[model samples]
Target: MINMGVSFKIPNEYGNHLSDILEPLPFNYYQWLINNDEIHIVHDNEFTNQFLFDEDKIISGEKLYEKSKNNTYYMVFVTLRAFLKDGTIKSVSKYKEFTESDCQIILAVYDCSYVIFWCKNSQLVSKMYMYALSKGYEDIKYITEEELIKNKYYIE
Candidate 1:
């Protein structure tokens, strides 16, 4: 497995308050985001919510919560699902159209912000919990349902 170093940030509008989450990792991307305008909120929006979540199926929120609850770490998972067309990683998929010849990399990213807050707040994190609550659909993911499932998994 290739551990692609996270030398990038998710843009400021995605919220720059990552200290609560990225305190452990030597986050080089945070500074990169601060300096570059190309990696702005709108860009992150297209790259993250639109490209990543919509194109690739990533599990976030509750699923992520359960995955690393004991560990204090936050990460945005990015999957580049691109294959060679003629002789490169740039292949045109049926889903999208492309005329370029460069290596085509289908990127899928997931921003896991909940893990950080869970560590910082511990239990007295009403504010953080509120944020997690807002991330899900109230009717689909009710407290009672969560209790029954005893599992934290969300796909979007």
Candidate 2:
């Protein structure tokens, strides 16, 4: 079963540069890295407004489209446990199967416990959710964008 937690959006500043800001992270961090620019497209124009807010500088949809044309936006999920086949934890990057170029979002399953799903296409987001389920990943919690913002400033 999918466990619904607080859903949060990853800050715009942490957009494509997640690797730079996140520290003291779990070992399977590399699994969240997606270099496929083709997978980050915003399919729904209506929701483009939200992205505009995240981008902060885009004044119009045309501009947003142009700016993101070559870049891919990703939503990554990180889990608390490792889901590797060998039960060995190592930082590594793996490429996803490029079945289609129209894929605009990515659901990054971290450590098999935490999940981060990023994308402008709601359809793609749903697909990723189902994909996760097909893989037998049920202990999933959705973090809120507000939580992410709050976590960014979290001081321990």
Cα RMSD (angstroms) for every candidate in the order listed: 16.2, 17.2
**Per-model TM-score versus the true fold:** 0.20, 0.27
Q: Give, for candidate 1, the lowest lDDT window spanning 10 residues.
A: 29-38
Q: Model 1 lDDT vs. the true structure?
A: 0.27
What are the per-residue Cα lDDT tens digits for candidate 1 across 54-117? 3212332332223233322323442222223333333232221322433222222345322211
Clashes of each: 5, 20
> Model 1 residue 90 lDDT?
31
lDDT of each: 0.27, 0.32
**How well does candidate 2 score on lDDT at residue 117?**
49
Candidate 2 global lDDT: 0.32
Regions of model 2 farther than 4 Å from truth: 1-115, 152-156
* TM-score for predicted model 1 compared with the true structure: 0.20
Off by more than 4 A, model 1:
1-15, 20-109, 112-123, 130-149, 154-156
